[model samples]
Target chain A: MKDVSRLKSVLEKGGFAVTSECGPPKGADPQAVLRKTELLRGKVDSVNVTDNQTAIVRMSSLAACCLIKKAGLDPVLQMVVRDRNRIALQSDILGASAIGIRNVLCLSGDHQSFGNQPDAVGVFDLDSIQFVQAVRNMRDQGIIVGGEPLSHPPDMFTGAAANPFADPMDFRVVRLAKKINAGADFIQTQCIYNMERFDRWLGIARDRGLTEKAYILGGVTPLKSAGMARYMKTRVSGMDVPDQLIRRMEGVSKDKQREEGISICVETIERLKQTPGIRGVHIMAIEWEEAVGEIAERAGLLPRPVIDDQ
Target chain B: MITAQQKPIDEIRGMLVPYKRILVLGCASCVAECAAGGQKETAMLASTLRMKAKMNNEDVIIQEHTLDRQCVKDFVVTLDDIIGSYDAVLSLGCGAGVQAVAEMFSEIPVIPGLNTEFIGETRAQGLWVENCLGCGDCMLYYFGGVCPLARCSKQLFNGPCGGSVGGKCEINPDVDCAWQKIIDRLSRFGALDRLETIYPPKNWSRKQGGGPRKIIREDQQR
Candidate 1:
C-alpha cells in the first residue's frame, strides 16, 4: 500500500496510456535497447522489457531492466522461472530491486522444446503464480530462501500475464484473480484482437474484482503490413482478429499495407480507450515502437492524464 | 541395436511358467538407444511373455514400465507402484545397469536378459564393437593418437615382425596390422620423431587395476 499513486497517475494521462515493448540484443550488446528508449522516451509512460523472448537467449531481462532504469525510463522487467529454481528467482528479484527496476511480469515462459535446442531438457520448476507468491514472501517476511533474514529485502511491483482469447478463456480471469490474490500488483494481458470478446471478458474479470485489486494493462500490437497481419492471423493462436480488419487489409496494396496498418492500429487504440472498465493499453509495435507514439496521437488518444480522476 | 541381456526372456518365462503373475521393467536411455530394452521393448516382452505363458496353460499378470533413467536416483524416486507390483526385473541393459537395479530393489530378485558387452562404439548401422580397454592411462599421444592397447593384435610397442606381409598382421591375414597403420599415419604427419622413443614395458597396476578407480573433482562436486 506504499503509494502506487505515481504509477496510477502516469496511466491516467493519454486517456489509455500507451506502453511499448523492446527486445534486447541477441548477444550482450545493449545498443538496441538504448535506441528503443530514445525513440519513445517521453512518448510513452513506461517500457516493457522481454526475457529471452521466445526461447532464444539474449541479454538477460534484469540487465536490460537496469539499463532502462539508468536511461531514466520506467521498466517492466519480465522474468520466467522455467529454467531456474526458486533459489535463482529470489536472488534475481533482489538484484532487480537493488537497482531501480520496480515492475516485474511473472511468466511460466516458453517451453524449451520449442527452441533451437529441441533435444535439450526442460525444467519447469515453478509456474508464474508460484513465482509471484515467492516474490511476496521475500518482500513481506524479509526471509531469505533458507529461512534466514536478509539485511535488505526487495520492493518490486509483481504482475502476471492473461489471455482472454485463449481456449477455455473463462479460466483466464479466474487465474488472473488468483494472481492478484497471490500478490500481483498489476496485470499486462496477452495481445488483444477482438475488442468485443475482450470487453465481454472484462465483465468476467470485473465480477471477480480484478479491476480493483490490480492495475490491468490491455495489450495491442500494430500490424505493420498485410504479411504482419497474416502472421498474427495464422502463426499466433488464441488471437481472434475480426474479419472487418482482414477484409480492409485485402483492399490495400501490399506496398501500402503498412500505412493501412498504422491506420487500423490507430482505430483499434481509439476504440479500446473508449471502452469502460479498461485501465490502460500495452502497445506491442512488434519492433516498430517508433510508430507507437504517432499511432496514439493519430487515434486522438494523446494528452492522457495519469490515473483516473473519476 | 537390439539384444537380450538380463535373465533371457525365455529363461524368465520358463521360471515363471507355473506362476500367474509377471512384471517387466525397462530403461529408456542407453538400453532404449541400443533398441534392446525400453518402453517399446517392455511392451513387446510383456506381450511375448504373456503369449508363451498362456500357451503352456497358465494365466499371467504382466506389467511394463520405462523409467527415464534407472541409474539416477531422481528418476527412480517415484517408483512405489513399480517396486511393490512386480515379481521380478528383466533388465536388458549392460551388467552395470542390471546391478544398479538389484542394488536399488533388494526385496525382489533381478534377472538379466542380455549379455552385457564391453564399453563399445557404434561401428555402423545397428552395430557396436569394443574400442577401448578402459586402461588407467592413455598411450595414444605417443602412437600418433592410434591406440595399440586396443587395435594392435599383440599390444605391440614396436611391431610388424617378419611374419607380417602387405601390412597385414601375421596372426590374422585378413586383419590389417594395426601397428603398420600407426607407423604409416605417423610418417604421413612427419612426426615420426615420436616413434623413435621406445616405450617402457606396460604398467599393469595403474591400468587394469584390480579395484575400481574413482575421480574426485572437488570443485565440480559442490
Candidate 2:
C-alpha cells in the first residue's frame, strides 16, 4: 500500500495507462528479457513479465522481473499459484519486493496439463482470489498467509486477471468484483477480439460499480495473420473472437495481414478507451514486442504520460 | 465408497519378482461394488500370476482370498490363519485398506495391486465416477450437492476456471464443468443467488495439509 509503483501512480493520477507484456525466454538467458524490456521501454507505463506462460518452462517470472528492472523498465511480476504453494508464493513476494519490484499480478495460471510438462504436479494451494487476499494481507497487515508477523512485509500494487469471454459470461463481472473485494488494485483481462461483447461486459461492470473498486485494463493482442485469427477463434478456449474479425483478417492479402492486424488492434484500443469502465489497455504482442511502439503510436497511446515520482 | 483400479499386469508381476508364495487379497466392499477388487477379481489375478510364474519356469505358489472389508480389524483377522504361508500379500483395496492389512501383518510385504482412485459412486453398470475428495470440509450445500473439489479438475471452489467451454472442461471434453452443473442445479432449486457470493480460499488444514486426520467419538467408543 505504501510503495505504489508507476502503474498504480498513473491510474491514481487519472492517466489512461498503457501496459505491455514481455515473455521470458525458455532458457536462462537474461539478454532475452533485457531485449524485450528495451523494446517496451518508454513506450508503455509498465511491462508484465509472464510466469511460465501457457505452462511452458521458462525463466522464472521473478528473475525476469529483476532483469527487466535492471533494464530500466517497471516490471509487473505475474505470479501464478499453479506452480507454487503458499510458502513459496509468500516468500517470492517478499523476494520480489526486496529486489524493488512493486507490481504483482495474481492468477490461477493455465493448468499444467496444457504445458509441455503435462506430467508435472500443479500446486494450486491458493486460487486467484485467495492469492490477492494473501498479498493484500502481507502488504497492509504485515502478516504471512499462516498469520505469522513479518518484520518487513512487501509493499506491492496487487493485480489480478479477468476473462470477459469465459463461459457463464454473466458471472464474469461478479468474479471481478470478488477479486476487487479480495484486494486487487487493478485487473488485466483476457485478450479481446469482440468489441461489442466487451462493451456489453463493461456495461455490466459499470452497472455493478466495479470500475470504482479496481483499475480495469482491457487486454489487446494484435493478430499476426489470418491463421492466427482462425486459431484463436477455434482452438483457444475463453477467447471470444467474432466471425467478422476472422473474416476481416482472411480478407486481407498475406503481405498486408500484419498491417491489418495492427489497424484492428489500434481500433480496438481506441474503442476500449471509449468504453465506460475501462481505464487503460494491456497490449500483449507476444513475441512481436517490437511492434508495440508503432501500435501504441497509431492508437494515440504514445507520448506516454510521465509520472513525477520514480 | 472408495474406488480403485488394478495396476498393469507387468507392474504387478514385477512387484512379485522376489516372492515365492503370494496371496492376492481383495476387499469385497467398495472395490467389489466397482468391480475392481473382489472375490472374483482375486481368483482371476491369482490365476494370471500363477500362469505367468509357470511360463517363466518359476517355483511360486499363488493363493486367492477376499475379505469383507480389509479396512476393518475383524475382517483383517480372517487372514491371520493362512497369512503365515505367503511371502507377500498383493492387496486389491483402496490405500486405507492396504495400510490396514499392512498394520495387521507386519512381517509380510503388502504390495498394492490396485491404485486407489477416489471416493465415488458407480455411475453405470461398469463405470464409476468420482464424487468426493474426502477434503474433510464439505461445501455440497452451497454447490447444490455437486462437490466441486471432487469434480473440478483444479479443485476450484470459485470455478469453472476460464477453460470451461460449452459445458465441458478444457483439460478433457468428456469431463463436465462442475460449476456449470452447480449453476444448473442451483437455478433449478431457485437458489442461483447462492453463487453470486464469492467463496474464499478453502481452509486447507481440514484437508491433508494438517497431516493424517482422525475422528474419535467418545460417545460411540463404549
What DockQ does every candidate get?
0.01, 0.60
Give candidates' CA RMSD values in order. 25.4, 2.0
What's the lDDT of the predicted structure labeled candidate 1?
0.68
- Candidate 2: which pairs clash? none
lDDT for each residue of candidate 2 in B78-147, tens digit (9 for 90 to 100): 8989999999999998898899999999999999999989889888998999999788888999999999
TM-score of each model's chain B: 0.80, 0.96
lDDT of 2 at A83: 91
Top DockQ: which candidate number? 2
lDDT of 1 by residue, B87-175 (tens): 77766555666678777778776666657655556667777655566678788778887776666544545432222345665445566
Worst 10 residues of 2 chain A by lDDT: A1-10
lDDT of each: 0.68, 0.89
